[model samples]
Each structure stands twice: as structure tokens, then as C-alpha cells.
Target: MSRLLFILALFLNTVYSCEVCEPCECNVIRFRRRFLCTADCSDRDLTSIPGTIPSEVHVIDLSYNDLHSEDLARLKLFTGYLTDLNLSYNNITYLPAQSLSTATQLNVLNLDGNILEKVDSTSFGHLKQLHKLIGIHAKTFEENSFENLEGLNYMSIVFGSQEVSENIFSHLKLKTLHTNFKTAKRIPEKLLNFGIDTLVDIYLDVPNVESLHENTFSGLTILKSVTIQTEMMQTLPSNLFHSGVNDDRKMPVNLVTVMIDGVKSLPRNLFDKQQSLKHLALNNIEDLILPKSESQVDTLDLSGSTLYRVSADWFTGFKNLRFLNMSRTKLVEVNNDTLMPLLSLTVLDLSYNNITNLPDHSIQSSQNTIVAFNVSHNQIRNISSLNI
Candidate 1:
């Protein structure tokens, strides 16, 4: 009898048990004496939530399924245990109001490849604990679409329709945002008024934008980086980068990086207000205009521009400039006084230009601080007069 009992235990151990999440593969991950389980129901022809998913499941991958929008209502069964949900490439269209109201512990949600038309208010009101939201491509987001998502800090979305309202994101406290304006030509000033106190980085890919206003980024107090990539942008206002002013402080101090590509013209005093600005890149700009007043920019990249002759006054106000790159900018001559005011410059790149000569006093002022200088791929015929 003892030998028969041992044989039965061996048979049980050999057969895999999937009673926790039948029809889905369950993986148990052990971490610090804790067991976290994931249920992968992807690529299944599931029309609704599996009834066998255990309550302890933390992550669920329901991608490439035929689940309709109503099938998501069954998620309430695993309310507190569900942390991540990937509903990508599904047949979901409209999200019912309050469908996920009981999911208080949910953190991350992905809804890629869905043809969602509208997001009404209170749809995500109960998800106060959600952290990152990804792939929310909708035509319109109602006034309070993100009403109670107080913990949502990161988002990557595409505004598919051109009728997106200005206040669609006014309720979020995101720290990082990556948005693509599909058909919008210009971003309204108040479109990004959300996350004033917490936002750190923002990326805007506007393929059709033609111009930008001065107060496009006015309210944020702690924003650190701004990158705008466009193919049709032509004009920029002088105060485009004016930093947010604090009540107790007179000067702005948080903003540090600014990069804009594919622009035609830039107005004077463009960065005069950014006292803490450090790195600036204006690549592929057809017509470049240096700021008339002093700026604290440390790194400046003017590559792929249409500069024929670099003027001496361009670097006069850039006293704190360090790294300068003018590679691929059609330049004929870099006069002697052109870099005289860049006393703090450390690295200079003038490669791939039409320059014919590296004059003796061209970089004389930066001799003490300049460490790397490149003038390769130019029409330079004489370097005998240069000291180094």
C-alpha cells in the first residue's frame, strides 16, 4: 500500500496542473519569497474573459483576441490583484461607462489597435491608482475623460482626429508625455496646461505643423525637456520658450533642454527668458537667427542649415556656450572674429562645409578652453597660419 501511494504522487507530479487559468498559459514568477503569476491569453479566439482565471493573477495579456468591449466587464472579479492589462489588437470599440470602476489596484493599461471613437467622462474615474497609460488612440476625449486618474504619470498616445479639444488632458499629472498630432497644423496654447506641477519631459511630433505661438509651453514649473519635430514648421515667435515664473522667484530655473527641427525662421530673443536653458539644437533650419540677447545655453547644434556666411555677432551673446556644431551647414568662410566671444567653448565642429581656409585667429579666443576642433571635409587649402 505504501508503494502504491508513492506511485500515485509521482503520477500527479508528472501531469501539469492548469486549474488556475485553464485555456491560458500561467507563469509563476518568484521574487523575494513572493509569487507573482501572469496569465497569457493572447492569440486565443476568446470572446469573453476566461472564467477560470484565478483571483491571484497579476498580469493578463489578452492581445490578438476577439473579445468585445463588453468582455472587459468581467475584470472586476480580479479587482485588487490585476496590475497590468494588455488589450492590444482586440475587437474592442466602445468602453462602457464605469466598466472598470472596481479595479482600484490596476496600474498599467494598453489599448493599442482599437478603433475607439470617443472617451466619455467617468470612464476612468475609479482608476486613481493607475500609473502608466499607453496607446489610447481616440477621436475625442470628453471633458473629464481622465477625471480621477491622479496617479497616472506616463502616457504615449496619438491624437487621430483633427478635432481634439484643447482641454483633453487638463486633468492629468503626467511626468512624461509622447504625443503625435496626426493632422493638426498648430497646437493651441492651452492644450498642454495639464501637469503644471509634475511634468518633466514632453515630445511633440507634428508632421503638419506650420507655426508655433509664444505661449505654447507657459505654465509648467518643473518641465525639463522639450523636443518638437516637424516637417512643415516655418515660423517661430520670439518668446516661444518663455519659462514659467514662480511667485517667490523672479527667474525661471527648471527648463534645461530645447530642440526644434525643420524650421525656416527663428525670431530674435527666442531664448532670452530661459535662464536655466543648457542644450539647444536647431537642426535642418532653412534660415537661422541667433538670439540678440545673452542665453545660458551650453551646447548648440546648428547642423544641416543653410548658413552661407557665419557672422561674428552671432556668438557675441553666447558667452557661456561650450559645444558648437555646424556640420553640413553650407558655410563659405568662418571669419576671424566669428568665435571670439565664445570664451567658454570646449568643442567646435565645422566639418562638411565649403570653408576654404582656417585663418590664424579664427579660434584664438577659445584656445584656453577649446579641447576638440574639427574642420574636416571642407575646402581648406591652407592650415599653415593656424597655431594648432
Candidate 2:
């Protein structure tokens, strides 16, 4: 009898100590877990993540929670297999270094809308495997905060009112850095240090920058496109598009697009040595000027700018150009030589301008390649001289 009681007690203990499996409905599930252990819970209204989170769970969504810094620390149990974590739109202010130091397998982390003020270097020291990080709408980072994330590949900084520290991204291997009109002053000089020799695109939305410092974009050798919001700009620096000292040193040999809107004037040599620029948009500009004989731009758009006139030799060196737009500029006259050197010109937009007359030789030189012409909304009394 004594032996029988001992065996029964041992069996009971073993049964109670084993991890229990929980039931989940297939209809309401978003992610599928392999173990289905008691370790994983979603939308449980548990204000805090328990430190005993099952070590086997790989993906965790603590989103839409009121989790603060202290509550986030409770997730220390997930230091092993937690690869993907989303803590967006939470009440967290600061990320604890201890909580992140052990997360070895973490690859993708999203902390988009938290009240974070600064990211300490140690917060990302252990996340060597991290690939994608999104901190779009948070406040700015402290200096050298991103010094430890050298292995990161993809990053996004969308729609925020923060000024990123200069060289804030010097250490990472970023593919995209999307920024809106956040900073009121000039772009931080450190922004040019990000080995742009490998960058594909840089989308800038600084509508308030009136003047860009010369040599502001000196190192973007491999850059493809640059989109700038120019609604509040008055003038563009002469070397706006000259990234390097010489043409051969530029990294982005196949530069594609340059989009700008709402500027007053473009200085001469705006595109000095950029041989690869293809599509250009100068929308909403009030005053516009083309480069001298030494310039080279492929496609140009001057639509929505209040332009008044185009003098002779204004577009002298745009020999490889294809498209040109001068709509809504209030232009009354264009010299005969304005469209002479543009032998490759295809499209011209002269809409919404105060153009009541065209020069007698307006089409004298542009008879062969000119494909489409827009003269709508002009005060033209006759179309006899105009021919496309």
C-alpha cells in the first residue's frame, strides 16, 4: 500500500507540472502559433506583460496597449525567440536597455508612435540581427543614439516634427529614409555623411528651407532620385544638384528624377555636372530660370510657376532634353532662340500664362521634333504663328 501511494503521488505531481495547452478559435486568429502553449496571449487587457512569457513564442503583438516602460520590462522572459515585436501606439516613453539587451533573435521592431525622447546606444547593442526598424512619428533622437545599429538594412522615418541629429544614421546600412517638412532650418550637415554611395533614394520634404548651403549634397554618389518640397523656398543655391567636386566622382551615375515645387528662382548652373537627370518637376514656382551653356538636364517641368518671359539662350545647353512645361507663368513672349537648342524637345506646356502673342519665329526652329504644345488659358488672339 505504501508503494502504491508513492507512485500515485509522483504521477499527480508530474501531471500538474506539465504545461497546459490552450484552445484558440480559428475564426478570430491573425497569426498562427506552433505550440499553442499558455505562454501566448493577445488583447487580454493585461496592462503588463508577464515576465514568464513562454520562451518558445517567436512573434508577439503588444500593440494597442497602455504598456509603459515598467510594463515593457516585464517582457524580459522573451529574450530568446522573440524575433518580431510591435509596440506601436503605446504609452511607453523610454525603452529599457535591459529589456532589449537579451533579445538576440529580434529582427523587425516597430515603435512608431511612442513618446520616446531619446534612444540610448545600449538599447540596440544586442540587436545585431535587426533588419527593419520603424520609428516614424516619435520625437528626435539623442546624439550618437544610433551608433550601435550598424547591421540594420531597412529604416523609415515618416511624418514627424523632430530634427534628427547630424550623422544620426551614420552607422546603419539604411535603404530608405523618408522625411517630411520637419526641420525649419537647413538640413543637418551630417545628413550628407550617410554613405550615399549605396543609397537608392532620398525623399526630402522641407518646404521652409529658403536656401541650401553650397556643397550641401556632396557625397551622394549612388543616389537615384531627390524629391524636395519647395513651396516656401525663394531661391535655390547655384550648386543645388552638384553632389561631388567633379563629374567622374559622382556615385549615382544614372540619376533619374529631381522634383521641386513653389520656388521663385533657380540660379545658373543649378545642374552643373549631373549628366543622368531625367525627369524634373518645377511645379508652383513663381520665377524660373534655366542654366547656361555648360548645363545638361534631360526632362524639365515649369508648370504652375508664374513665369513672365523666356529670353534668348535661356535654355542653351539642354540639348538632350525631351519635355518642357511652362504653364501658368503669365508669359507674354518667348524669344525665337528660346526653343532652338532643344532639338530633342517633344512636349511644351504654356498654359494659364498671360501670353497674348507668340513671336513670328516661335515655331521656326522647333518644327521637326516638337510633339505636343499646350497654349490653353492664354490671351492669344490668333494661332497663325504657332505650329507644333
Candidate 3:
């Protein structure tokens, strides 16, 4: 009887293995008490979508293959069930009008490494539920290319060394935009105005950008985070964060994080309007200018800067600051009252400087709250047991 039971079990296992998604791996997932499958068909050198992949597969990864636009017709089999699809690093150039007409439930799509040059209204018109889009390296986008993506909250795209079309992001309500473009001297004010009501975070990775104007971020009412990285920037406008009175929104501005690297000079009142900013990073500034305005910033980073001395007034408004990183800022000394205003500072990194001594009362005010103090790679040669 035991031998018969073993034979039956073996036969059942063989039958189940034969019905599995082949040339790809499927992992059964129990979501909401339903047994769903996620298929990974990456790096299979597949020219076409495998017919063996079950229609109930919720997530499909067909990256690193030779798939083309014609192969996407197989997505019709999954229809309204597929949630996530990754076809990155493929040779797909053009998306047919009806290619994704049935993918109404697709939430995330990644098409990173394809050389698609044009994106029109029909390419992604049916993806109403798409929340995140990764890697759209398109050159020419029609006016209404993204009008149907009402639910798209995050997008990562390359603008391909051309001027950004203002109408490309017309009706979409994006919350975060991570974009890259070369050859443009500055970001077009009109392009960002499209999502001004909903855009919260904007990361500009333009390497060749030369300058930014005061009205660069004019009307973004609910904007919170802004990180700009450009090597060619010389100076930042003092009112770069100032939202003019022309914007009629009543809600309080909520700008929180600002990181601008590789600039020459920062105006003294550069952050006078960003009172709600918490994390500020101005690394690699040639001539660092400390803002005189009292801010609510908690985490400050001046790494790779060239500040020679720190004054007591610099920390007057930094009472709530906890983490301070001045690493690589060419400082020669810290005055006795330099850090007296930082009542809540807990972590201080003053590494990679030319400081020779720590005065007895240099950090005396922060002795109680200070936890980790790093001064390595400095020219320190004095004995300050109280600060050790």
C-alpha cells in the first residue's frame, strides 16, 4: 500500500511540473486568498512571448531579450489582470495603437534601454492605472502623448539633448519627476507649470545647465523637495525658492529638502523664503555663503565646500538641527561660540579640514545632546578631553 501511494504522488508531481510556465520561472503568490503567479522571463533570448506563460500571471519580466513591438500583442492574453510588466533592454522601437489597449490594470511598466524615438497619443493610452513609468528615452513626443495617464504619479525619462515639449506633461498629475536632459541651458518654466498643482518632488540631473532664474520654481504650491545637479552653474538666484504672490494658493508652502551641488557662489538670503526646509545640502560650492535667515533646517551638509571659518551667528537659527556635516570644508578653526546656538545638535562631522585645535568651549553647549562627533583627517594636534 505504501509503494502504491508513492507511485501516485510521483505521477501527480510530474503532471504539475508539466503545466508550469516553461522557459520562465513562476512563483505562486497568495494575495487576498487567491493563488496568483509571477512570471520572470528575463534573459531568455526570447523573440516572442512564450505561449506557455499562463494568462493569470500577475507580474511579468521580459527584460534583456530580443522582443519587439509585435511581441506585445501577446499581452492581450493577460488583459485586465497583469499589474506589473518589465520589457527593459529590448529592441522595441514602436508601440502599436492597440498593443496595450486591454492592459487596463497595469500599474508599473519599465522600458528603460529601448531606443524608442517617438511617443504619441496611442502608445500608452489604455494604461489608466499606471502609477510609475521607468525609462522612456524618447526624442520626439507628440502634444498629447501622456494625456491618458491620469494615475501616473512617478516618471523617469530622458529628454535626449533636446528642448522639452511643454505639452508633453499637460494633463498628468505627477508627484515625483526624475528627469535628465543635456544641451538645455535651463529648465523651461512652462514645462514644470503643467504639474505645478500636484508636483511635490523634482530632481533635475542636467549636467550642462548653466544657470537658473529666480522664477524657476515659481508656482509649485505644494512643492517639497528639489535637488539640482549641474556642473556648469555659477550662481543661484537669491529668490530661487520664493513662490511669488501671483500664485493664489492659500495652503502654506511645504518646501523641505534642497540639494544643489557644484555652484560657485550662493546668495546670503538664498533660503530666506524656504522657512520649512529641513534638510539642506550645498556641496562643492566654490564660495559658500551662509544664509542669514532663521530657518527650520535640521540636517545641514556643506561637504566639499570652501568655508574658512564658522561664526556663531551661523548656528543661531539652527537650534533644531541634529545632524551637521561640514566634511571637506576647508576650515582652520572652530571658535569657542561657533556651535553655541545649536542646542539640539547630536551628530557633527567635521572631518577632512585643517583645524589644529578644539577650544574648551567650542562644542560645550552641545555636550549633553552630542552623541557622535567625527573629526578624522583633520589637522588636529591639541588635547581637548572635554570634546573627545
In candidate 2, residue 232 scores what lDDT?
A: 67
Model 1: per-residue lDDT, tens digit, 57-119? 778899999988888888877757678889988988778766777677889999888867877
Clashes of each: 0, 5, 0
Give the Cα lDDT of each candidate.
0.80, 0.67, 0.82
| Candidate 2 wrong stretches, greater than 4 Å | 1-135, 151-154, 158-163, 230-256, 284-287, 294-296, 335-337, 358-371
lDDT, candidate 2, 23-67, per-residue tens? 211111235553222233444555777544455555666666667
Off by over 4 Å in 3: 1-19, 31-35, 43-48, 64-71, 243-252
**Candidate 2, TM-score vs. the true structure?**
0.62
lDDT at 129 for candidate 2? 85
Local distance difference test, candidate 3: 0.82
Model 2 clashes, total count = 5
Worst-scoring 10-residue span by lDDT in model 1: 243-252
Model 1 stretches astray by more than 4 angstroms: 1-79, 84-103, 110-115, 122-126, 243-254, 360-388
TM-score, one value per model: 0.72, 0.62, 0.85
Candidates sorted on TM-score, descending: 3, 1, 2
lDDT of 3 at 253: 53
